[model samples]
Target: MHIALVTETYPPEVNGVAMTNQRLVRGLLAKGHRITLIKPRHQEAPPAEHASLQVHEVFGIPIPNYAGLKLGLPRPGELERLFEADKPDIVHVATEGPLGFSSLRSARKLRIPVSSTFHTNFQDYCADYGAAFAARWMMAYLRWFHNQCALTTVPDPSLIQRLEKDGVQRLQMLGRGADTVLFSPDKRDPELRRSWGATAHSPVALYVGRVAAEKDIPLTLEAWAAARKHCPELKMVVVGDGPVRKKLERQWPEVHFAGMRYDEDLARHYASADIFIFASTSETFGNVVIEAMASGLAVITYDYAAGKQFIQSESNGHLVSLADRQSFIQCTESVIQEQSKMPPIRAAARATAINYPWSATIDRFNHLLQKAAKTEQITPQIDIVSNSEQSTL
Candidate 1:
């Protein structure tokens, strides 16, 4: 099948959505599916060449407060022209940004099947960005945007329930997978640990994601600090960059800020750590959690999405009640203090993570896209009111 994949983020951008989209593209390509990629041109360097993949980089504006990310601009007419030139079997919208919206509009206008995936909880992020009042508006927009699609794919069942409550229709669960081979216990580097001022005896706590307020990074620091009191040699390393990196660096001078590490480097960082602390409460699904688990680290994350799905609390990895900062800290400290339990927990984590491979994810994704393509095109719900020969969505 030929699929037109539309997204705002892609490779070279160190984020879950970007990485996941890249993985999906690779998976689909491996399955012999032709892909037409549409994304923001955040950099001048073109994406890597692929035999079955076509690239379309569009004009984009740097997203405010999100360093290294871009908000794709709308190009409906341009997209329509491209689609008409080489029509795809289905349009898979991976984001809800302007570009994705335009892709949906153009595809629907051409009576093509279009599906979407809800990767991020954008409405939930409104409160974190001091726009609590806008959450309702954001959610309403999301409901309308997703309902227009033949089906809206979600990462977990919890998100499906939430979206359904919000009036979004035809929601399907599409779980994510981690590269167990890329992120494995064998990748653990003692030299890397030594560089972070951590010895074999010392416990290292690692956080690998955007250093932003929405991520609840402050809570990770708090947990690390509390754990440090119990284990003086405890080293905390944060391995990502974001808008608040500078401020966080100033506030937590003790942390080994490794900035951004990708591929094997990221895996090494995860393996070298003894425990993984992801305090983010705003994730639709935390990809880092599975990556850390695959790296054989005793993870401590909130009990939701990936955490709830993969973790068996006190067995494979630790799961704190959602949004309970106090429990999160206590869980971190407890996991560190019970040093003997780490090996078993890490082993169990790896065991669970390996079961979710990209092959299975890709199969499910292909099935969903096939289903979408075969289904009758969904009528777009957005009312088009024309004023002065202009149609507003």
Candidate 2:
């Protein structure tokens, strides 16, 4: 099948959405599917080259407060022209940005099957950005935009329920996977742990993600402080960079800040750590949690998204009540106190991760796209409304 994928971000972006999209594209290509990838061109990165993959770069502007990310601008009729020239069997929008809106409009104009994936909680972001009042409006817009698609794919069942409750139609659960081979306990390096001033006995707490306000880094730090009071030898390692990195570095001078390590280095960071902490409540699906678990780190996260989906609390990992900062801290202390159970918990975490493979995820995605295409063939075509004319409607 020839598939057209529209997204705002792609490879070398150092985010979950970009990485997942790249993985899906490669997986689809491996399955002999021709792909047309439409995304924003990164200034510093070279274009991706593949035999079955066709790349289309569009104009984009840097997203405010997101240092390395860019949001694609709407192209009125460009997508329509592309689709008409070499029409695809199906269209998949991996983001809900301006580019995605245009893609939906273009696909509809061409009477093509179009589906979407909900990767982020943009409405929840409004609260983090001090625009809480706009959350309802943003959610309403998202619901309307996704309802236009043949299907809307979500990463978690919890997200499907929440979006359905909010009146978002055609919701489907398309779960994520982790690279177990790349992220394993075998990747642990003694030298790396020593570099962070962590001894064989001293526990290392790891946090890997964007160092931004939306991540609730302050809550993680607070929990670390509480855990440190009991385990004095506890060392914190933050493995990412963002807008608040400078401020966080200043505030917690003792913490080891390994900014933006990818591939093997990232795997080593995850493996070398003893425990993983994820404090973000804004995530639609926390990919880092699974990555950390796959690396054999005993994860302590809130009871939702990936944590609730994958973790078997106290067995594989620990799950605190959502947004309960005090409970989050207490759970951290419990993990610290029961150090002997860490190995078993870590083993169970790795075992759980092995069940979720990329092949399975891609297979499900391909099946859904095929189903959507088949549905489009049987359904009657409707008049296409261009995105530019959406405001008037």
Candidate 3:
């Protein structure tokens, strides 16, 4: 099947959504599906394209206060023209940005079936950014945008129930996968641990994600501080860049900040660590949790998203009650104190990650696209004339 994938983020962006989309596109191509990827052109370098994958780059602008990331401007007419020229069998909107809205409008205008994916919790993000009042407006807009599609795919059953309760229509639950080969216990580097001032015995706690307010970085820091009281030699390593990095760096000079490691390097960082710490509660799906688990690290996360979906608490990994800061810190201390039992726990975590392969996720996504293509098209209610109107948030 020929598919048109519309997204604001893509490869080289160093985000979960971009990486997942790239993997899905490659998987679909391997399955003999032609995909036309519509995304914002990178400022530095363009990504390599495949024979079956056609990449259409559009104008984009850097997101405010977020370096190394760009938001694509909507191009409904251009998208319409491109679709008219080639005419894909189905359209998959991977983001709810302007580009996604434009793609939905274009597909609707041409009477083509379209489906969407709810990857980010933008409403929750608004609360983090101190714009909590805008969450209702944003949710209303999101409902309007996604309701135009034949189906809206979510990551887990919890999210599906919440979205359905909030008036989101036609919700489908789909799980994500991790690259086990790339992220494995075998990739652990002793030399890398030495570089971070960590010995074979000293505990090294790792955090791999955006160091932003939404991630609840303060809670992670508090937990780390409390854990260090019991395990004095414990080293904390943060592996990601975000708007809050500079401020956090100044605040916690003892913690090692390894800004933005990708692919093999990222896996190495994850494997070298003894424990994985994630305190974020605003995730539709936390990809880093699975990646860290695949790398054989004893994960400590809240009981939600990937943690709730995959972790079996004391058996595989440790999970604290959602939003309970005291429980999170206590759990960390308990896990650190029982360091001797971590080997089996890490092995169990890796075994669990091995069960979730990327091929399964790709097959599920492809099946959904096929189903959407076979379904009837829904006409769009909003009128879109040019990029100017659609580009505005």
Candidate 4:
């Protein structure tokens, strides 16, 4: 299959979206499929040398205040000309951005199959930038943007339900995968654990991913504060960097910040931790939970989205109740006190992660693209102005 994967982020960026696309691209190339990877030029992007992967560099404007990265803006007619020059059977927009929108418009003009992935919640993300009121407007824009594509893929059934309720047409369940080989129990480094003030028996809790307000990071701090009452050595290791890093580190100097890690280095950090705590309420899929699970770590997360789908409370790890912070603390401490119960929990978690493989996931994406190309383009059946204000939760 000839596929053009358009995304705003790509390799060397080191986030869930980029990491996910990297794996999918590698897998697709291995399966004898060609992929034209389109993305903005980041300072850290790897060399584009793969024979099967064609890299198209787009003009990037700095994402204000953000160093080493930029965003691709809209240029519809230029993209249309590119599509006309070299056509692909499938045009997949992996991220929702100006570049993706332009790609969609171009693909539509060329009468090619079009598809997209719902990787993040920009509506919820606006709140982090102090534009909370703009969430509704953003949601309305997203609904219209995605509905134009023939197929839209998200990671969970819960999100699929939510998107359907929000009038998202032709929604598809496209699960993400983790790298089991690197993120195995064998990657655990006792030396590294000791360096972080963790004794062999002391409980070590972890939060890995981007450090942003929308990540619900403050809740992790709250949970850690509660955990410290019972176990002082209940160390918290935060392994990622973002605009909030300085503030978070200054606010809580005792916490260890490992900064951003990628590939095998990241896997080691996941394996070394005793318990994985994901307090985020806004995740679409929570791929880090699966990565931690694949690395054989006991997980404690809320009972929704990724957590509800994977964590079986008391069976694998505790799934904290949303309404009761005290109950959450109690359940968390109980698990930590009996931290001996964690090995089996971690094992079961790792066992569950093996079910999601990148090869199968990418193959499913290809199949969906092929199927959508044969179906009628998803234009609205009725013309009714959608209320942009009522979409926010």
Per-prediction TM-score to the true structure, in the order listed:
0.96, 0.95, 0.96, 0.93
- Candidate 1, 279-333: lDDT as tens digits: 9999999999999999999999999999999999999999999998888999998
lDDT of 4 by residue, 1-393 (tens): 788989888768767888888887887788888888888977667787578888887888877655545688755487778777768777889887778878887788678878888988788888888999887778787887788788899989988998888777788998877778878888988998998999888878899988877777777877877878888889999999878888999999999999988778888889889888888777888889888888888888888777887778877777987645666667777876777787788888889888876667878876787787676665742222255434444
Per-model CA lDDT versus the true structure: 0.90, 0.89, 0.89, 0.81
lDDT of 2 by residue, 1-393 (tens): 999999998867888898899999999999999999999877866656678889888889998767778888856788899999979999999998889888887888788988999999999989878899878778877877787888989999989999999888888889999999999999999999999998988999999998988999988988888999989999999999898999999999999999999899999999999899999998989999999999999999999999999998999999999999899999998888889989999999999999998899999998998988865533333333335445643
Model 3 C-alpha lDDT per residue in residues 264-311, reported as the tens digit of each score: 999999999989999999999999999999999999999999999999
Estimate the TM-score for candidate 1.
0.96
Cα displacement (angstroms), candidate 3, residue 325, comes to 0.8
Each prediction's RMSD over C-alphas, in Å, is 3.1, 2.9, 3.3, 2.7
Give the clashing pairs for model 4.
none
Between candidates 2 and 4, the TM-score winner: 2
Sliding window of 10 residues with minimal summed lDDT for model 4 = 380-389
Instruction: Output the worst ten-in-a-row residue range by lDDT, candidate 3.
Output: 384-393
TM-score (C-alpha) between model 2 and the true structure = 0.95
